[model samples]
Target: MVKTNAMRMLDKAKIEYTTREYEVDEQNLSGSHAADMMGADHGCVFKTLVLKGEKMGYLVCCIPVDGELDLKKVAKAAGDKKVEMIPMKDLQKITGYIRGGCSPIGMKKQFPTFIEESARSYSEIVVSGGLRGQQIALQPQSLIGFVKGRFASLMQD
Candidate 1:
């Protein structure tokens, strides 16, 4: 398995994680599809999202593939009036990772990060590994601490 910047960052931090790689399907690059490819539970697989806030500029959000991000809740957590997803074209420039490969760890710069509160229910969750066809599974708390993230009601009911 190829080591991505995210995996390296975790290694440097002495964070324990397991990497899983799957076949990439450009036409169907959804987290749920990735979860299916890895034979992982969809609820345990997270998709990292980058958003631009009215006041904060940029922020990172991680939520389960099966859930939807509550923009209002994210704005509240970010202390902004509103938040919108960054354009796909600007994703790499802003986060140094492309669409199907963005990770909460090892971005060009660490922006404020929020993980869905439900993540606390899982001992370990899967996140992108800074590259397509790769993922990292680690304790949610460890990931939250490493990224200096807070648990928020990020997902929609």
Candidate 2:
């Protein structure tokens, strides 16, 4: 098993998660693309996004592969009047993970993290493993427990 900071964090928290690794394809590295590469259902895969809310400068937002993030709703959920997606250059500084490899767990700093309600419906959800070509699969509750993330309707219709 790769001992990434993410895995170490999960281990420290005693959160149960399984990691899978694949070859990095420079052409396709997004969550949806990774799901397709892994032959996993898109609904079961999630993407981690960082946003700057009106009140909150940096927050973690997790949405499913097929879902679109509603910036307005996310801002409201964060108790911010408005929200803007954080820039790629600022991602590592904020979350400690690169754009295509950010995960909800093991961030350099703990920020308010929110997961879409849809994630709770699945038995397991896949997320970036803190590195390209890797993903972690785990139960929603475990993820919530580890990250202490709030559940919200941050997804768009």
Candidate 3:
């Protein structure tokens, strides 16, 4: 099995997860879109977002496939006065992954991760497996264990 950073961390943390790979569709830019194309439940699909904290540079945000991220809420969740989405050039430079492939786990640095509080509503959630065309389905708690992410209403309404 080819392991991405997320998978490697899953192993190191002894978290149980199932890997799922879907075809890469150039037309999709959201998790719900990807899930529908892959025939997976949209509720269980999660999207990874990379944000910049004004001058702080980089942070990771995880929210449900159906949810939209609220930059204001994320700033509050990060306890920062302001937050902004990282530019594509910077995202690729820092994370070593293309726009659609960023994962909160195993970035160039271990960033503080924030997840949508609603994610706990699901038993298992799927996140990018650290690369395009792959995802991992694991218990939300196990994910929290590995990333130690804080839960908050950081998604957009």
Candidate 4:
């Protein structure tokens, strides 16, 4: 298996993680599709999103494939009065990752990250491996610590 930047970062941090590779369907790079390919539950698969807050420059959010991020809650958790997703065209330049392949780990810069509190219920969760068709699985708490992130109510009720 080809190692991705995310995997290499984990290795360097001595962070235990497992990788799963699946065939790429560029037309359907949704998180749910990835979970289906890995034969895992949708809730255990997370997507990383980058947003810019009015008060903060940049922040990250990791939510379940099946969950939706409530922007108001995200803003509250981020201590910003408001927040909005960065334009897709600016994704790579800002985070060094493109949509469908962005990982909460190994971002170009360590933006303040927040993981859905629901993830704490699971032992391990899957995230993009910093590349399309590759995924990384690791403990939820481990991810939070590695990313120096906090657990918050980031999803809609």
User: What TM-score fits each model?
Assistant: 0.98, 0.95, 0.91, 0.98
Worst 10 residues of 4 by lDDT: 20-29
Q: Give the TM-score of candidate 4.
A: 0.98
RMSD of each: 0.7, 1.1, 1.6, 0.7
User: Which of the two, 2 or 4, has more lDDT?
Assistant: 4
On a 0 to 100 scale, what is the lDDT of residue 83 in model 3?
Answer: 92
* Candidates by lDDT, descending order: 1, 4, 2, 3
In candidate 2, what are the lDDT values of residues 1-157, reduced to their tens digit? 5678888888888888898777777877777888888899998899999888766778888999878899888988899898999878988877788878898888888889999988899999999989988799999888888888988999888
Clashing pairs in 4: none
10 residues in a row with least lDDT, candidate 1: 115-124
Which pairs of residues collide in model 2? none
State the lDDT of candidate 4 residue by residue for 27-137, as single tens digits: 998999988988998988999999999999899999999888899999999999999999999999999998899999998899999999989999999999999988999
Please report, as a residue range, the 10-residue window in candidate 2 with the lowest summed lDDT. 21-30
Clashing pairs in 3: 68-156
> Per-residue lDDT for 144 in model 3?
73
Q: Which prediction has more favorable TM-score, 1 or 2?
A: 1
lDDT of 1 by residue, 61-103 (tens): 9999988999999999999999999989999999999999999
Higher-scoring candidate on TM-score, 1 or 3: 1
